[model samples]
Target chain A: MKHRTFFWFFLPTGLAMFLFIALPIVSVVTQSVFAPHEAVLKTVENCTPLVGCTTETTIDQEATREIREAQPLGRFVGLDIYLDRGHLAIAELGEAWDTAETWGDFWDRLFNLPLYRALAFTLTFTFIVTPMLIVVGLMIALAVNSLHRHLKGLMIFFSLLPMIVTPLIGSLILFWMVDSRGIIGSALVGLAGDPNFSLKASTGLTWVMLIVYGIWHSAPFAFVVFYAGLQTLPKDQIEAAQIDGATRWQQIKYVVVPHLMPLVTFVALIQLMDNFRVFEPVVGFNASAHATSLSWIIFNDLGGETRQLSAASATSVLTIIGVAILLSPVLVRTWRDFKGK
Target chain B: MASKAQRRPLGLSILIYGFVGLWFILAAFPFFWTLWGSFKVELDFFSIANWTNAITGERTKATYDSAFTGAAYHGAWVQEEFWRNVINTFMVCFFVVLTSLTIGTLGGYALSRSGYRYTFWLLITALIFRAMPPITLVAGYLLPFFEWNVWGILPTTIIVLVAINQPFTLWMLHSFFQNIPKELDESAKVDGCTQFQAFRHVIVPVMWPGVITTGLFSFLLAYNDFAVTAMLLSESNRTMVPAIAAFLGTTYTEGNVMFAVAAVVSATAPLFILVMFFQRQIVSGLTAGAVKG
Candidate 1:
């Protein structure tokens, strides 16, 4: 296609992305630097016939409103917002380091910061779920590959349910079943021989439930990709290995896994990005008390009567940075592929 | 020679089948259990007293003179007025898909056909945009939308969603367009046709499969989104996901958890039908990236 033709063809989508996607990123970065304006203060002195003179400092609400209205993005605070207790918490980090007597205590104090706490959970969820899903998906794909042809369609039809459902609804379904009064929770109580036992009451159990939810929701994507990879496995290679006295396990270890390596990497990259933004499950499971992610923190900030836009913007910048870091490997690979082509 | 001997050992086959059976139950049993529980009264569905009450609808029978009850669904659909939100969701989904696909197709096709290095950079840019969480973009939009007084309406949300949907739509359709041999359009150009004429007469006819696949994905992205719709929409114009979330927030403290449960099931019912009808397209769309990459 000619340059003019290409330009016209690409103009509409390009303009939409520039206006919405590119511009918002710039806006978020710009907003993060500016904190909301402070209230204007004034001092007033009053002398009354019956009382001594008194002076007081009060907020000039009218002046403050005018100032804020004039500059709605608030005053530029540079990196002040980023270093506050709600975010990087630089001062809190220093205080914790100064007070701690040992490494474990220092680590505990570090995780106490809200930002660090959220980062810990987000990274833990991402790393744990990605690899576990790959292994579980491979096992499922291998087993299903060996099944009778008729069962394949039925298995796939059922397998897509958890993945295709809305993330909130999927998590809600699991949440209800595991509530203290629900069947699974009740069964657990019976098994433990204690009626007071509840899954909701513990931090560790809730994390486990959330991780299980993550694995349940995402494993099907891996399974489908790996299953497709399994179809093109070389029959002659497997037969040759078998003729050379290789057992089934050995053949699979040598042949099947290597063939699926690219698909494995594909699943890993996609899952890492997906799991980093884990937010809906937190809402659906009501696990925010026990678990919080960066996305969840941003959502919490934007919500309620306060609508803390600056705070949310700071966290948004940090999240975009985190995603960019996770995305670098894929970007590098794409660049290399493009150059090679 | 080794066909018979190559068969798995009987014990091994049994273990594989056992594992598969277990996974099948784990993958699918949650929906079935929830669908069953949604019908019974709250006490019987939860059943803190007797576990069998959940399966037998023991409390539902005592109150309503029937083992099954439609009270939860009635409460969710009628009393809660969740139908309004459902209509809003479809409205948002319809416009987002239409606008995203309309532009995404043109841009993706252009990028694929153009033999220039700039196409590479554009795709990389789209990838970066696609990777950023939509919630992050919400923070950027809040101030402007608040200032302009356009934050809480359906059209603003629709346009925002279309933009959010653009990156992935472009990426998916770009790959799909690449799969269509370039010769189809080139041949038309060799005749007495301009570039647009070739795209209209020659390329469009053969492009439905790829476009449909990409469109299916765009619909899923718009439908499954929570962050954009939840934050951008007002209380009166909320989509189904946000509405269900609202039900949870309000109903949980009110001792009406079943309202949220019913709403969740109602929200999932459309997705169930979608999967039933378009399973192939979804699967193909999913593996399209993995297989090509």
Candidate 2:
């Protein structure tokens, strides 16, 4: 293709991405370093015949409005928002470090910061869910592969349901089922022999519910990928392993798993990128009280009557940085492949 | 494999069947349960007095004089005017998918055909864009959209979704186009067809299978999105997912949780139908990326 034709062919998508994806990234970084204009203040003095002069301070609303209108991007604060208590909390971290008596105490204080708390859960959720889903998905793929052809299609159709449904809707379905009066919740009450045992009341239980929901929502994706990988498996290699007198487990361990290794990596990388943005489930499960994620923090900031754009932008920047770090390995590998080609 | 299965131990086969059966229940049972529950009243759905009431709809019978009723659905679809949101969702999905596929096919074809290092970089840039959570972009868009007075509307949301859908679409169609044997287009070029004419005549007809697959995914992304729609749309123009989210806020306080339940079920019905019809395309599209990698 000629450069001019290529340019015309790619122009629409390239322009859309540049305006929406690329430009917003720049906008977010710019907004992060800026803060909304503080209210303009004025002092007024009133002298009365019988009383002494009185001085009052009031917000100059007109001036504030003019300033804000003139510069809608807000005033540049240069990383002040990033270091504030709502974000990195550098000062608070320093204080907690010095004032803590024990390592456990220090850790508790560390988790108290909003950003750190969200970061902790996001990382924990990403790390735990990705690996567990891979194992569960692989197990399902193997089990389904061994099934009769008639049953295989039915199993796959059912399997895709959890993954195909909207994330918030899926979590909501699970959430309602685990309500105190709902079946699963009542069953748990009976098992524990405690009427007041509520899944939502404790942080640990909420985290567990969210993680379980994560696996349920994403495992099918892994299963489908691995199932496809299974279809293209080398028959001779499997037969050779069988002829060597290898057991079923050994054949799978040596022949099957190694063959699916690339698919596993592919699934893991995609899941990592996804699981890091764990926002919808938190909202659906109403687990924000017990657990939060980086994406959720940004959403919370950007929501409600007070649109805290600067605060949200800072979190957005941090989240983007996190994604870039998580994506670096894949990026390096892709670069190597491109170079080799 | 057939012989191997026959030679397998009985206990092992039984275990595999048992596990798959358990999994089948786990995967499918929740939607069934929810669909059944959505017809009942709040008390029956949440069953405070007896868990069996959820199954039998005891309170629902007491209230509506029937074991099952369309009262919740009526309340959701009529009283709340959820049909407006439903219409809004479809409109957004329709435009997002159309625009995304239109532009993505051209760009993807260009990338596949171009023998340049820049094509590699463009895809990598797209991969990075794909990785960024949509909420982050929402932060950037909020200020500008509000300033421009285009923040809360369907068209704006649709364009944003199309843009967000581009990276994945390009990658998918790029791979698909790569497999089409460049010789087809080259042969057309040899017969006095310009590049555009060749694309229009030769490539377009044969591209539907891949295009359909990519379109199915594009539709899914636009349909399943919550972040962009929830933030970008106004109250009157809200889509089904965000509308349901809003329902939770008002209905919970009003003791009308059944409304939200019905709305959720209604919203999910279309996706169920989509999967039923396009299961094969969805499966192939999913594997398309991973298999190539």
Candidate 3:
């Protein structure tokens, strides 16, 4: 009777995921195969428009002055800023700059430019941060856990502050700190007695700062999860290891780490999924000649002409594939490992 | 006690702690910078700047005054893009929450508690949504949805946002429902409570934390989003993040203080309120699968 009554459970949630999530993902594959440059061009040529062409976002002259003046290079162009658009030649921003022309060539560059670079950066970032978080979180958890059983209920609540701080805001806060002229940077400059000092002047240094910022905003979750996972572990396993004269390192490596593999895998997977979604920081950073990520690159494509969306969508579809191909192994391993348990 | 304390390199611990502590300060500074910037005027930002030759420091309070006024010199936020975004945000939040909760709770209870029909298909459905990149999905069909709308871009954006959010809320709710034991519900029904009554009295009480977490997450997703909103929304319906982003290299020339201030205030409000208040409930269960614990 219970099972019979509950039969309708899947429809609402199932249908929603189908119509929205699954359908869009499938759309990516279909669109990629079908949305060749020529096809997209033809579609744009035929379609009327998403919005009326008469509409324009005309900025007030005074405000526009401040905006134009803010640019390090006088003024950066608007949506039509894509160098290869129509007949404009992109003055290569640097020799390091990768170039793409036409929608197809651009598609190649999409993969070549930031896709893998961002992917690698994201992966490395995750690899380093997740472990750090777990360690820090575990230590905090142990300290909190050992004090008293009554502390468990309260400490558990206290440990969740970072979850409430959206990653977007977290990233932004980091951005301002290491910002070229931000207070910390200013202090560093003052110490050096060099007014023009900027942390971003050193390329490697800049990346380190970015990674450091990522970990700061993210570590709390790792700590809390390890803390909770710590609670679930039996006291006897560690006690037995200690009694047997196992070093603390041996106990953690065998007893603790083995117990934590599932949780560690879960944390790594979630962070990996989110790491690619790195738009907030890259966007918020608001410094440097260029700061592009896989997500930001795709986002930039959409803001161009309405016709560019198909091309943008194509890149997005490819990105989705890229992620699937990359994460498939890790995901499968996680599933298999969990199933083995 | 002294030997124990002196066993390891004391200096290394200090170095590690210092690095971590400094990182936390850096991680959390932009928010405070925004808070400080929000209280000041545009002129003040220019004069008392972070740098003399640096671009970020050059942006003034005037940029902000113009953003709210949209008049460059004087107007109202109500007449500006900011007010409309707030309206759009509120409407989107209200509808998304109400609809998604109803669907997720009902669906979750049935999926978790009962061996119901088509459960396989439903689980697949949830997984599929969980899998896709949101920005891409929304961008692909912006035209299709836009054509179907009448109120310029507002209606189209609202619909798409709601659609993007439904899956996760449902998934989270399902997990919430599953965590409770079947005995709790059976016992309640045995005591003369109906199915709905058991859910309302017994299950709902136990699972309120999950519901709140799901709601808060969805709301944040809706609120903090920039890429999807930028892709789907037209200028008039532009949300605050994109608007500030646009302002970065546009309206105020390169005056970032406008963006600096607005980004800080608009983005931090909900997060600050939620984290500082229901900090535990926010993290407790919703992210359980994602985190180790």
Candidate 4:
């Protein structure tokens, strides 16, 4: 029988996407509204003693800290998943915001600390990584493109090999390389005068390492696409540019870059959408390194006991929004530029 | 492989080689190290032993056997009984490829020949699914699938990989179909053949290159993916990449023989054959869809 004869063929793919990809996100968004019903808040009350704290404000502060420094085995109280309902204002006019007893005893805890913080972090990570990748990728592409044909092909293939290795493998290489006895380990000890030197766990260094790793993982395809685009440019125009006595830099900047603009725009937007869901490499190394992206947070929650599917789903929703927002500027630019083209 | 006559000066060649050499090392260091580690004992791994050490030396079958045979290297060296895994890997790849090819081909045919605006919608979904992070899917819905026992390993993996791949494969094969001239199909129809028969005989044979290209790539995705298969497979049925990943992710020190084993399965053995046998076709296959500007 013909496949299209069944309604399932056409319907299943779309249905699956909606049921899985979009539904999780929608449920997550609705979770912000579902907030936490009264009974769910009981888990948070239990959490208070689990993490030591005497007063309400201190407890809230401590809870916020715990959420931020989320252990792999962290308890998944559904309430702390929301944003800054930590303060709990009692003296507001009506009965909307007043919570006199516990941090979880909230009627209106929409978007608490962890939720917003993760969203912000995910956005920031995406913002930084995307542009860095584009710039670095273009530079490498240009350099590789200028080489002789034989040299260029070999160089390109070697350079692109990183894209094939799994992020888990890549991160393990990083962990081993930068570990004390590994390549950087002995070198770091020789230079920094300490045997125990792990650049991965250090705060700002982690961000830098992640961006480097992300670029290392990603930039090859961009280089390949840009190279392909460059290769496809009309040879007559290049010959004409040379005949007209344009310098190499002038030819590259004016003609080559313009010619590759469409490819650049496509890569930029794709990378923007793709980078938001950063998880594997971060978790591959350690849970603490999972700080910069929300996907990692969702994965972190999913692995824990309560498994906070509701909160993780909600986080995925915000992550979806964050991805849309991240892409909006690039997308709008692409639309305009593409239309102009 | 073509050596063009425009040879640069020797000094510039060194500079280019030096720069590219460092970058390649950086890119390939992990794979190289994994290969090395896969042969060395855990004890030998920590210590800077003799020059033939697994850290930076030739990884061979003898080293692998020693790692397995001898229990003196810190702890007993980890060896995945390779033959069962080899069979399991074949089953996973074969089912994944077969399933993806069927859906992708049918879907691609519909999208290309259907001549509807919905094809564009299908195209968009394909791009998004292709671009969507694999790790996101694993944590997001795969867990739910596993918990519910909705589908077992072979069925579930085949389903997931096909769904994930259908959009891209369809997208890939659409252009291949478009390249086939409509006149042949029209001529066949004019001679009394139906649309389905015309496609099977006339269109498919002509688009053999497209089928081969898309099929190989779909196979690559199936073979290369760890994130999807990691969440899906238990110890009883791990794919090549995820099986190797277990060595790295574990708490105890294990011998690196698994890395060589994985490299052999995932990249070394099959790819070596594929590349050697059909290098030109494989290159064109990748370049046709992916190398486009």
Indicate which candidate wins on DockQ. 1
Estimate, for each residue in A31-101, the C-alpha lDDT of model 4 and write its tens digit: 43343222111123224656775432224555555554453223445444444232112223123345435
- CAPRI quality band, candidate 3: acceptable
- Please identify which of the two predictions, 3 or 4, would achieve the higher DockQ against the true structure: 3
Deviating ranges (above 4 Å) for candidate 1: none
Q: How well does chain A score by TM in each candidate?
A: 0.97, 0.99, 0.65, 0.70
Worst 10-residue lDDT window, candidate 4 chain B: B69-78
Candidate 2 regions with alpha-carbon error over 4 angstroms: B1-6
lDDT of 2 by residue, B1-293 (tens): 35763387989889999999988988999999999999998898898789999999999899989999999999999999999999999999999999999999999999999998799899999999999999999999988898799989999999999999999999999999999999999999999999999999999999999999999889888888998898899999999999998998898899988999899999889989988999999999999999877
Write candidate 2's Cα lDDT for A216-259 as tens digits.
99999999999999999999999888889989999999999999
Q: What is the iRMSD of the candidate numbered 1?
A: 0.9
Q: On a 0 to 1 TM-score scale, where does candidate 3 land against the true structure?
A: 0.72
DockQ of each: 0.86, 0.84, 0.29, 0.28
TM-score of each: 0.98, 0.99, 0.72, 0.74
What would the per-residue lDDT of candidate 3 be over residues B91-183, giving only the tens digit for each residue? 766666766776778777876776644554465455545555677686556544545564246555655666777767766776777778889
Per-residue error at A261 for model 1, in Å? 0.5
Comparing candidate 1 with candidate 4, which one achieves the higher lDDT? 1
Interface RMSD of each: 0.9, 0.9, 4.0, 4.4
Model 4, B1-293: lDDT tens per residue? 32232335687567656766666777666656645554554434343333234444333334654443232222312344444555666777788778767656655665666665556556765665565565455545544574588533656776677667776677778777767777887789888987667777887777777888787777767776665676666677766666555655553354453343343324434644554455445545544654453
Q: Tell me the docking grade of candidate 4.
A: acceptable
- Which candidate should be chosen as best, given lDDT against the real structure? 2
